[model samples]
Every structure is written in structure tokens, then in C-alpha cells.
Target: MSGKTVIARFEQGKETFEILVNSDLAYEYITGKRKDPMSVLDAEEIFKDARKGERQGEEKIKKAFGTTDMATVVDHILKKGDVPITTEQKNRLMEEKRKQIIDIIARNSIDPRTNAPTPALRVENAMNEARVSIDPFKGPNEQVEAVVKKISLILPIKFAKIKINVNIPPEYSNRCYGILKQYGLKSEEWLSNGSLSAVVEFPAGMQTEFYEKINNATQGRAETKILE
Candidate 1:
């Protein structure tokens, strides 16, 4: 890992525990990719004030973390604590999460004007210009709505779902049910004639692709209607 040392801090009832750690490995530990917390630390000592060189007593460490075992205590501190990160590292993480945020928006949302998915490049451009900020630690899915809201003002965007009534010929019913469920088969019924009638709901942006799949599956014989 990067050998750059930094402090990871966590506070309990009346105790604050700090550990000096390698910045890169500390992140991996917190993210659970690293199983051994001690491997990330620069020093084996816990401290009430690391910068002051004031070491914490074992009793206090045990009281604050339940067990004074260094590895477990270190795990708690790194996972539940605030770890200092460099500006460059923070920006790099935000950029990666930025792409995830963009994918979520582009996949599930559509341009209301055309009822189609906006080009991914357009969404990326909107993100660069949007005033919203991305949280490096919080998941990208959690940040998508706020980012979409900000970008919506500049792009004709809206989150939409399309419901469809689909009828499959008897020959294709068994074959097409799997496809229906893949998109979202809301409900289904078997007609007396042995064909399948299903209600499907999926993202509005998938309309073109959905049509392509269903038509291809039935050799252009599947019939469907938009629900309103």
C-alpha cells in the first residue's frame, strides 16, 4: 500500500481513539478488502491524541472498544472512524464514483422530450457542469437522485417507468416468459388458447431495446400495447 502515514480517528462515549496508518491500506481495511487491520497501521499503539504522542491506556481502550485486542480495536477505528485522505486521492475516488453515478442516471432515466435515454456523453458533460458534489465514501446509488436533480435542470431528463401489455403466441409463450421476467414481468396469465398474456413494467429508456428483444424472440409476431 502507499506508505503515506495518516491518522484514523474514532470517538466513543467519552473516549477518542486514534491510530497512525498507511493511507492506502487503511482505505482497503475500512472497505473490508484487507482483513488484517494491523497491517494498515504505522504504529501498534492506540492514542488519545496521536499528534501529541499521548498514548491511551489499555483499560480505556478496552472500555471504548469492548476488547483491547489490537486487531479488533484497530478494525473498529478504521471502519467506524474518519480516516484522513489526501486531496489527490479524494479527487480520484470522486471521479470513479462519478462514473458510477452517471451510469445509474443514464440507464434508468430518459430525456422526457424524446422519451429516450440521453447519450452517456451528454450525462457526463452535465455532471461536469452540475453544481452538486459527490461523496467519496457514500455509494454512488445513494447520490444518483441528487445528481440527477441537478442535471435535470440542464438536460431534458426524467425518471420514468413504462408498463406494457404483451401477448405471446402459443409457440413462444414458454420461451418468452424468461425474457419478460428479465425486464420485469409484473403479472402473467395463460389464456385458454395456451398463449401467454403478461403485464411488464420496466424503465422507459428500455422501450427500444425491449421491443427489439421481444420482437426478435417471436420473429416479429409478439403483440404489445403501451399502458396509457
Candidate 2:
């Protein structure tokens, strides 16, 4: 398959430098999926010269990057990119991330000072104050660790995972099955009497909210057990 391309650029004061590499590799580096910044050079094709000696080709690449230090050039390339995302697109992405952050907090975190679930509004406000940076291309769950670190400065938070066993009576099984399925139901069985029993796993922070939801859907008739 053919490879994709991307241009990385650096500008400081009055000087500018640029390098070209496989777009996939550049994204891997940008997203922390690739550990070595210099790896970009392994796939580098910017200095193609069959007639020139290796030393000459190296010199040309360095000159093009305006630096002899590979590390410095890699740093510059990583910081700047050729593709530009629009402001509107950025705002929409931030909004989506903001909601994800709020949902995570509302579901998984409690105010240590009060031992109560932190309100979504409070989390939103704290996130805004912290000026958290959201990666538009990355899923919120994937970015949660860094985001939590930043927001922790403004709010007390903890993350936990929970597993639940739910039993829905025949009267409610059909009505509540769909809701339970969305919460990561692991295994489910239909009892002889037409009841439904399911084991589900989800983040602990969402436990209270999820319980309330399941109860409401089943009119407090569903039985639940927190396994973890």
C-alpha cells in the first residue's frame, strides 16, 4: 500500500525549518503511540540523492532542518504540523471532550470534602479553570489520565472500576434489558420464569448514577449487587 505524507515545520524568531515524513508515523509520534521522536527519520525520504555520498546527504538534511542536532529538529517537527484544523472544528471537539470529562466525573468521582458525587457543573467549571488541553483526534477515555492530572489541581478525584450483578423480574426484564446492555453487560441468562440476570462491569465512579438509572427503569424492582 502507498504511504501518506505530512510536513513538519518549525519557526523561531526569523528562522524556519521543515521536514517531510510518512503521515502515519508522524501521527504515531504526536499521539504518544511512538516512543522515539528520531524514529521519524527512519522513514524519512526528504533527502533522496543516489549520486551523493552518505555524508553529503546527511549534511543536506541538516541544512534543510537548519540544525545539526537531530533531537532539536525532531522536537520542532513534533510541535508544528502541516494540517490545520479550523477554529469551529476545534471548539466542537473541545465541547465533546468537555462533556466526556463531565460525564466521567459525574459517574466516577465524589467530592472528598463532602463524600457526595461531584456535580457536573462543578467539574465543568474546574476543567475550564484548569485550561485542560483536549486532543481532538483522541478519544476522551484515552486522554483521561492526562486530563485527570490537570483537573486534579482544582478538584479532588479518584477513579475506580466496578462490576455489578443485576436481576430483573419478568415484568421489567424486557423493558430494562436494553439499558443494562449499554453498561458493559458481560454475561446474561434468562431464568425459567422469564426473568433476566446479568453481570455488568463499568467504572466505579458511575455506580451511583447507574444504579439509580436501573432502579428507575425497573421501578425499584431490579436487584443489584456490586461485585467489586
Best by TM-score: 1
RMSD for all candidates, in order, please: 4.7, 9.4
Cα error, candidate 1, residue 227 (Å): 0.8
Expressed as tens digits, the lDDT of each residue in 29-52 for candidate 1 is 655578888899899999999999
Q: Candidate 2: misplaced stretches above 4 Å?
A: 1-82, 86-89, 108-117, 135-139
lDDT of 2 at 120: 81
Give each model a TM-score: 0.67, 0.54
Candidate 1: the clashing residue pairs are: none
